[model samples]
Target chain A: MLSLSSQFPILVAIAPLMTAPICALFRGKAAPWAITTIASAFAFYISLQLLLTVASSGPISYELGGWAPPWGIEYVVDLLSGFMLVLISGVSTGVLLFARESITKEVPTSQLGLFFAAYLLALTGMLGICITGDAFNVFVFLEIMSLSSYALIAMGERTDRRALTAAFQYLIIGTVGATFYLIGVGLIYMMTGTLNIADIAARFPEIEGTRPILAAVGFIVIGLAIKLALFPFHVWLPNGYTYAPSIITAFFAGTATKVSVYLLIRYIFTVFGVDYSFEGLELTDILLPLAVLGFLSMSAVAIYQSNLKRLLAYSSVAQIGYIILGLALANETGLTASIVHIFNHAIVKTGLFLSVGCMFFVVGSTYLKDLEGIGRRMPITTFGFVLGGLGLIGVPLTPGFISKWYLVVAALEKGSVIGYGIVALLMISSLLAVIYIWRVVEVAYFREMPEGTVKEEAPISLLVPTWLFILGSFYFGIETSFNVGIAKAAAAFLMGGA
Target chain B: MSFGFFNYWVFIILLMIGLYTVMSRSNLVKKMIGLSLFQISVFLFYISMGKVSGGTAPIVVDGPLDTAAPIYSNPLPHVLILTAIVVGIATTALGLSLVVRIRESFGTIDEEEILEMKDGA
Candidate 1:
């Protein structure tokens, strides 16, 4: 018999998957909602178990069907994935806490069961992506996740028929991305003759200097960049996030791109080994500039967007730039900043988007013009938005500041002209965030309401969960031990390998 | 090694053709076809990688105890591509369904008209 501890990694994925079909078969909101919440809660528990085990005893590797590696699949859970699992599952559980009412309003009643089922399956796909130790397995789970996401986004047609175009656009682009990744995997297999990630890494050293390997790196990086909505490839995010059901906006803003970022980190640092990718390939020279441009340009676009959801979506691409900037830095502190920023940004964006969901719940529109004077109308909800905004701006004592501080420190440690130049660019982008965030606060708080507008608070269901996200953001900002400790260890592990 | 990489060239051409269709075409159904083509090219690439010059089927023939070696094509890539093919079909199905819904809601499947309507909205 497998010990419970030994089974925790797979259990984290299976819990939600097993419940997804059951949730789909039920009718109405409550039963499906209950099933989803219970499944996510159980997955969160398993993630916690995995985190504790990895924290105490280092990484855990589980082989499928009792088969050995290089032949059968493996699931590897180390500190980095452990941290991400906790964040993904924990935030998903938090979202499911109050999303039922929001979902009921956004989707037709008969389809609510299918909505929650897709949500749970998407969760399963992301967790599978995080835990798998094989390259090809990532492609399989990515398709599962992408297919469900297409369904979930299209279901937003009840609220806005435009969601169909958004879903279709995403489908085309996302398929190309996944197929490119598959091609990369096929090339790697041809060269290394192994499917397991560690096995490939073991074999890579002998075969490192080759054209196929370099091309594989290029394809995989581009593929994942498109998937994660890195700028220039981010055409799908704004429309997709804006038109989707508000609950999905919050859920995906927290998890999906973050998982892709985790995949990039794993492939770069673990599979190809950093020395081969960064130094030999000079990828830092390429990615650093893209990160800088993405950060600057996307924030500028966010400031111009009239729709609140789309604005947040653009900001998400900017935040992805920050994460990629850290990864590109290729240092211990830089990797830590990247890792911790993944957690910090996930919560901050989750809180902000959940706040937008509250507005959509109350005001029936999230356009900036429609949101005039909503701060007074929904004071507590606006406060949560302000807190989330503060976190985004890297204001003192917010989690965003902690991440930005590490990034700046990492740049300065390089102590070269280009490094200092990057520091200046980072500062400029943070200031740009201040401008966009201020526009919302100004319009919501100080702008006049139209003559007939009514004022009221959002329901406690939405308010409470939104508050939990903001509160957790501040809590982690204040107590950095848990997030930073694991992050620093992961950073050391990557840099040590480099 | 004279024509060892001929299969990769075929994959490259097929991939480019599919990508061009997805990018240049404006019809929703055409885009989905392009996506399937792109994915199918990848399937071809993986399946081709399993080919061995002198090998027969991967299945073992009747064997003696440690006699002469029997050459066989690598079977793992074929297995992996089977999964990929299934995923490709699922993606195509989902894409087509989304297009149906789009047609129902927008009264057209032309990408330009849909975007024009969205902007007009």
Candidate 2:
């Protein structure tokens, strides 16, 4: 038999993929949750090992069924993919820890088994996307993630019927997006006659300026933009996040769009290469304007939301704008900022949503008015929310500040007037972030508690995992070596300098 | 366009019709029909690409060891679409089920009515 370490790459994906069906089969109350948590923990451990192994040795390529690459499926774990695997699985494990208590309250007891089953399927899909090296496999995994999420989102109908509408709307938009991506992949395959990502990149130089290749790039970028929720195509995000079960919202907030961002990075930087994407197609000119408008307008829109979840949902979109802006900058620092923010934002946003879940657990509402004086009643949960809010505002010693700092430095390195303008735009958006987060603080801390309100905290089961993420973000912010070091290495690898 | 590119024209036209229906319709079931149509158009596009000008089925014959090998059409796209088709069915089923639940809860499946109720709430 092969050594266990030799199989870490595939095991990272298979643990969750294989466990999902078992989760569905178990009818016991706690069996499914136990299975999900254990599977996620296993996947997280393997991913961490994979990341360390890649960082120390080199990229690991595992062939499925002993079939060679460019023919059979292959799984590759490099610095970027390894980092993403750890991020996705790590967040999944943390969120699953909190899920037992939160899901118990929100989802019906009969549906709990199937609920965790879908969660595991979504986790498997995301991990598969990070590890797969084939273009067609990406589309397959993308569908897996999307279909499972639709069911998970619709499960929220038990709380509010609007979730059904939200899930349906997302289903329509998401299917169109995935189909567009498949068309793009088909066009590329027609020209290159290979579905392997590395093989396509190798053959691209010869067919660099061909019409089909250009169209493929156009279709692929647009499709991923929709999936990434880049500004104009982000209509499906806010409602979907707002109406989903709180824990599901937190889970998807952390992993789903970030995976799409990863695919975009892989396609642009690895498959198409920098010269073709930015200089040849002038993609920066398009992405820069959209990024600017996205952050500015979305932040402005966020400030008007009365529901705290809806407000943060809009902020997530605005944060995606910052990541895209970094990609548009197209420098080492810019890409580093983008890559690091993917980690930083996922941690911060997921923590924020979990804190909201904690509040909802106790008080049964997340509206600004309903959260009044919650700081006094639920001190631990409220404090966690405020700290996560500080991260959102890019305060010093928060992961958000580290990324925004890199962004400003990248803009300054441009040494052009447009660069200065982008710096100003970034500041204005952060200021908008302050306004929205402050609205929550004002309600939670300053407003008087309603009559007969008692001091009751969310149960420790939920609070512990919530603080695990909240404090974890703070730890990464101060240490900076783990997240930043990996991000820099990933940026270098993407820029083809490693 | 030449008759040689007829499949391309059909694919583009079907795609446009499906997309327009999805955008314009308010009834949830009709919207789902449109989505299935949209996905089916893509399946057609993929299947069309696998065809070779004068090739036979990809299966191997018994008496071809000494003679020239038979030309076979590409089979990869067909296999990929089979997976996509399964995904499409799942999406359609889930979407229809959600629509059923919406009708049960809200007493209507019209997009405008649902939005109006949400705003009033």
The numbered model that scores best in DockQ is: 1
> For residues A1-498, what per-residue lDDT tens digits would candidate 1 score against the true structure?
766877887788888989999999999769999999999999998998889989999989998888998788999999999999999999999999869788888998898888899999899999999999999999998988999998988877887888888888898999999888998898899999998998998899888879889889999999999999887899988888999998898899999999999999999998889898888898898888889899999999999999999999999999999999998998889999999999999999999999999999989998999999989888999989999999999998999999999999999987899899999999999999999999999999999887887878888989899999999999999999999999999889877863
Considering the two chains of model 2, state its CAPRI-style docking category: medium
Write candidate 2's Cα lDDT for A1-498 as tens digits: 899999888888788889898899888578899999999999999999999999999999999889999998989999999999999999999998898878888898888889999999999999999999999999989999999999999888877777888888899999888988988999999999999998999998889889989889988999999998999899999989998999899999999999999999999899999988888898999998999999999999999999989999999999999999999898889999999999999999999999999999988887888889999999999999999999988999999999999999999997699999999999999999999998888888899999999999999999999999999999989999999999998998889731
Instruction: Provide a comma-separated list of chain B TM-scores, one per candidate.
Output: 0.91, 0.93
Q: List-wise, what DockQ does each model earn?
A: 0.73, 0.69
* Model 1 CA deviation exceeding 4 Å by range: B118-121
Interface root-mean-square deviation, each candidate:
1.9, 2.1
- Chain A TM-score, each candidate: 0.99, 0.99
